[model samples]
Target: MNAPTASHHLLPQVQARDVPKALLDALQARFGAQFSAAMAVREQHGRDESAFDIPPPAAVVFAQNTQDVSDAVKLAAQYLVPVIPFGVGSSLEGHLLAVQGGISLDVSRMDAVLSINAEDLTVTVQPGVTRKALNEAVKSSGLFFPIDPGADATIGGMSATRASGTNAVRYGTMRENVLALEVVTASGEVIRTGTRAKKSSAGYDLTRLLVGSEGTLGVMTEITVKLYPLPEAVMAATCSFPTLADAVNTTIQIIQMGVPIARCELLDENTIRMVNAHSKLSLPESSMLLFEFHGSPDGVKEQVAVVQEIAGEHGAAAFAWAETPEERTRLWTARHNAYFAGVQSRPGCKAITTDACVPISHLADALLDSVTEAQEAGLPYFMVGHVGDGNFHMGYLIDPTKPEERELAETLNHQLVERALKLGGTCTGEHGVGLHKQGFLVEETGNGAVEMMRTIKRALDPHNILNPGKIFSL
Candidate 1:
């Protein structure tokens, strides 16, 4: 295998795992119309946004509920076939790729907001409910879910990756918000982990273990997550800095001062240009920091004053505010569209993205070094970051036809991950270790730790069937 990270990045050495005719027949007979063997449907479930082009799964099972998911898994388990649970398919890493042939268990239809406990500030939702949908469901209650991974990622998918996004600075990621899950084990048995209670000393903490397990452990059917009362006041601002360092430094200072800023994001000039062109906005073309403050009216004002003062000290041009709800929505929508903008900037190119997160104290150094390396590599690229927490992603757009370019991007990514590890940070912050970062996992967490992970995988999925060949090889 030519180091499978993205789909195109890996020149395959292994053939698709064999899927027996008997298993397909049984699935079709049991699921009836829910089962599909069409090439288009299989292809759609087989790959994610990653540049990988693995062969499509042999079939797809459109699961409608917990019973559907359980039955599908049981059938696949009978033949020791790999089962990949797919949500919105918005993952950047190769999380959805079926490197070993089997069946894709798509759960998009299982979307349901099971309950909204506004008084307790919690909500129960099915695995396929998208983030935007969840927010809309609880909007009337004056409570909102905070995790937004840009894409309208499903709650289940977010849980699998332990995803965090813009609001992570204040509200935290999936691991912090997710309280309970109903999961289907590899043997097709259903199990519930965690409770709606805020705290529990209840043994193994299986909730945390499965939160970021990346689907190698089990498939989550229902998710119960924490919610926060909507802030009395919300403020969004964009500050352009003279240089990228200035913006990164401003972010570092803001965090160090202990500001409970809701969201702090960084976008380089190139990314700004791309988003400007794609989103039809007239944002300034310079290194910029996007900040959002959520608190009482006076509290938001105080935060704005402190942040503006810090930005002024770091050579900020001017602070622009999106005061109205519509304006704020448009601005944030554009920001979330940055990835599409970058990919479109280089037509027919694959973005080999990096997710290296370091400590807050080393944010500036880590981000700057990675940017410099990308520039030196001479690739069409753009940069965006959740810098308040020292996590950033650099997208290196490369022509898949040019193997050399792909290799160059991989080298840059490897170097960046190595540097971040030296900084005592993770190789991946939000994006889970799909097929791409397995080596980096070993480097970051040592052989012993990874071996323990394998031990867990073997324990949960002895046949090596659940999302096989992902996170790490068994």
Candidate 2:
């Protein structure tokens, strides 16, 4: 029999009573009536937005405060049970999978805007605060948190994933926005890393270390992120291209010319078709570039003029611009809905997305080649990109019931990763290597670098009780 088949041989059934009683007792004592056996709704918290099927946590704890998280982690540490931090569960990668079957610390109950310091241009928020909620809360203050990942994902999950979106080109990503964090270590000690200062040469950059750690190192309780002042003028526009190459090339030109564009996203014809069906927007079935500019009226006009000239040289068609706030919002809303639209295009199909980032100069070639390769493989795929940042996503819709189809999809994904690495790019740009890209990480970073990462994981999570089976396996 094949190894995969042999491994699937009905293993000895394990009962819930096999779990450590001491840990359960401790949790019962700590939470009192707040905890319940029904909290073991593993099916609800097991998976993320990814296509993987993994086991959920043994129990779920709705943490309402930092102390609640601290206590939960402490008990899990005492019994050496895995503790996975879960947010909105909107992660594209399998970041929230409870592979070790312990406790999932759900922090959505902790949602609160702790403080908004307009003078400092920063906001301190509990982990559960969503990006949309934060934006609405600060709208009256004329400030906004600019890192938007399309989903109303919790601040904790976004920080954990180090997510970036269309606005990253102008406002920067979580790496640039997250000024500080209050974290609970594996042993349950609470510690704060970084300050509210705009710039810091301070101690080791622990804030960044935790930002993209994907919840393996610790649980984030509070986050302090930089805020940007609302732009005086915002302009949204869309331009179509005769060919994919033309659209990608135009994006390269726009970035090379250093036009202060807030967001520059590309959607291939395949994606546009899906969007039209899903969003009911009758857009031209051509590769398109969605752009946004933020500045004074004169600055916006100059930026748009330069972009138009560059795009026109590359055979851009129907360059429509939206100047009003309502119009701009409508434009962005459509763009943000692209992922859902792509998924809805093929009913009963799950999306297996690949995120690769390359140097700006190689982006056009890399993306064009990827689309061609996917086509040659006879795969149904769509491409959408944050072109200005040289990051893109190739979402392949596959039927989970077909084993051969799944294998083919995996093969295509592997080829895409190989191509990315060959072009001096990373397998993942925003999404972390949560199980799906572990092999890719080894191939990209090499064994030596991976060992260093494992060393850090060991140092921080000595018990391996924090998000076990993530980033790297023991």
Candidate 3:
């Protein structure tokens, strides 16, 4: 891998004045109805799941295939317009924002499960297919795709964000599962990286370089992901602890013992209260750990016994097990809806979530200290995590209309990032450095690394047309 030398250059920024009538005329002539002036509806494709509302794109192109993307990119390049690729629009860090007002290239129309190679246990999919949709398609095949981000986010966006979820502890993140990618480079050239050989010492590892690039380097048109066989026997259980530390300690023990646990999640007392109120489930108002075990019948039984003993040692109470499939589904549904529940607890409040990951041994201490800080500041927050992987989310409810409240929340969010860095963790665990964490990224990676990233960005996108003002500033 060759790293470019840092050179200072003034990158061009797109504005309303830069809208080329020639480009629009060309787009209309080429795409007909697929390209229209109505695409100038910046509100539709500009912002994402972030708290800040950025400037939207000057146009939105509904691409149906790789050729469509290439055409759009070529036209944008000719007009010097920034192009931003959009997926399900569920990005938490404003990855979809078209700040410079160019084109928002939407690929949802290209969604399709292209092929399923059952023999090799891999699947090829168009970028627009969501994780839930893929799982539904593969359900009957007795296989499953496990990179879940709690949102039914598009595979393209998931790969771009390097997303992970509850099952990541056992299955791994997009970085681990994505075997290959068919990408459209900044120059509108199509290329494929990686193969289905299961392992390789391939040059440069372009698959990974683009996986978390957040559309800065290229546009992902298709993804090849590794799949896993569905577990034969599964068991899920919930245990309440006298304190958050107790619950986290038990989770630490379970992981250290290598219990083969599929998912181990922690919900602080505040989060549990919110879940009970919103989901209408009667759960004890104490910190809880939701766990799932997967393996053969005997293996699951043995693992469950070991986990139970560890929980008992940590003084875990209300150790209820959900053995049936229906019960397990309901339990997980409740857990997945926890973020929504947290917001519903406050009728007029919007959620601003902050995620950070650390070493497993430090997770409990980090979580406990975070809760204490939030309480001392008199902020309303809920906590939940995929504990086995040491990733968690803190949901803060804020009055968006109040500037003071928003500023306070921002301060707390920055503090959280600083704390994570201090504890030797990335500013973000799953979410990429879209627009939210660029400052923290500078702090985390420092000037030298960021300079290297900028050099790569300039090398791949000299015209600054691909996702301008994201990950790195011009």
Candidate 4:
């Protein structure tokens, strides 16, 4: 959640050259109207959902195909200008920002569902295909893509950030769902890694390397990701707890017992109140757990019974079940809108989100202490998370004009990351180390491992033109 400070000057600018007029003219001629140098368009492409100050790109390229992406990158390579891949600009971190001032490669126009192998339970999509679109496209096949990051983000952006969401507890994150990727390297060379096969012992696993690279190593043009068969019977439930510890403990027990919960989300009383006002729903304004169970009817009932017993032990209230699809949608939709609800609760305020993931065994300690710390600091914050996977976010809403408020939020984030690291977790569970977590990345991985990453970056992008000043510095 911290903004960029002065210490992030480790990497040298690529040749220290401006995006030349010649390069912009060449791109405009090659792509015609798809290329734009208008300040408004450039400004729109530069900023994302992050709270960072806007750093606009020199130009914008609306790439419609892999060839278009290659051409843009090829041209940028020639001019030694950085190429930042843009996908919906829904990212919470500064992944899409043109920090070094170059080209914003907009891939949203390349939206397409290339292939769907229902029998194989795999689908190939262009970079611009959003998660909801993919799920809707495959609905007839009785299968769905499960990695819903709640923002309706593009598949390419999801794959780039290694996104996970409420369903990640059971279906897994992008790292597990993505099978292969067709990438455009820094030199504009198109390459394919991995295949549709379920398993591969082929080579160095470049698919993973590029998956969470955040477009630093290359640009992901196409993705083949695993899919899941829709559950025969689905049931959603909400239960309130006496405190955050009680709710987290209930989740810990459910996961530890090997229950296959499809989605398990944690929301605090503050978030619950905001959701009630924003979504027009009435629910208890207490620490609550929302859960969804998948499988046959009997399986779901058994899972619910077991979870009910677990919750009862923690002094949880009676379960509120949603048996119908419409009812389930209403329940989950409220959960997804937690961010907007929180933002609207406080006028003229922005949320500085924190993503801290720890092991299941450590969830209770990690969450309870964090909530206590935030309360002690007197910061207006709300809590939500995919707790079934030991990942959660704390949205610290602060006025942009208040420097002290931003500083407090950043301090709280720093403490939370330190706590997660000490508990054998990561600085970022799903969000990559985009400008926000570079310092934490070092604390978590140590300098030697970071240097190894730098080595890879240099070998792959010697010119430092592909999304420079992200993850780590050279």
Alpha-carbon local distance difference test for all models: 0.91, 0.85, 0.84, 0.90
264-319 per-residue lDDT for model 3 (tens digits)? 99999999999998888998989999999989999999998899899999998857
Clashing residue pairs found in predicted model 4: none
Q: Which pairs clash inside model 2?
A: none
* Tens-digit lDDT string for candidate 2 (1-474): 111221111122332222487787778788876554464466788878888777667777889999999999988888888888989888887878776678888899889999999989999999999999999999899999999878899999999988998888888889989999999999999999998998889879999999999999999999999998999988889999999999999988889988989999999998899888887788799999999889898999999999999999999997888878888877788888888887887789888877899988999778988898788878688788999999998888888898777666677777777777888999898887886787778879999999999999999999888887777776
lDDT of 2 at 268: 92
Residue 82, candidate 1: alpha-carbon lDDT: 92
Error of 3 at 63 (Å): 1.1
> What is candidate 4's CA lDDT for residue 202?
86
- For every model in order, what is the number of clashing pairs? 3, 0, 0, 0
Each candidate's TM vs. the true structure?
0.97, 0.95, 0.94, 0.97
Model with the higher TM-score, candidate 3 or 4? 4
Model 1: how far residue 133 lies from native, Å: 0.7
Which portions of model 4 miss their true places by more than 4 Å?
1-17
TM-score of 3: 0.94
Off by over 4 Å in 2: 1-18, 32-36
What is the lDDT for 351 in model 4? 87
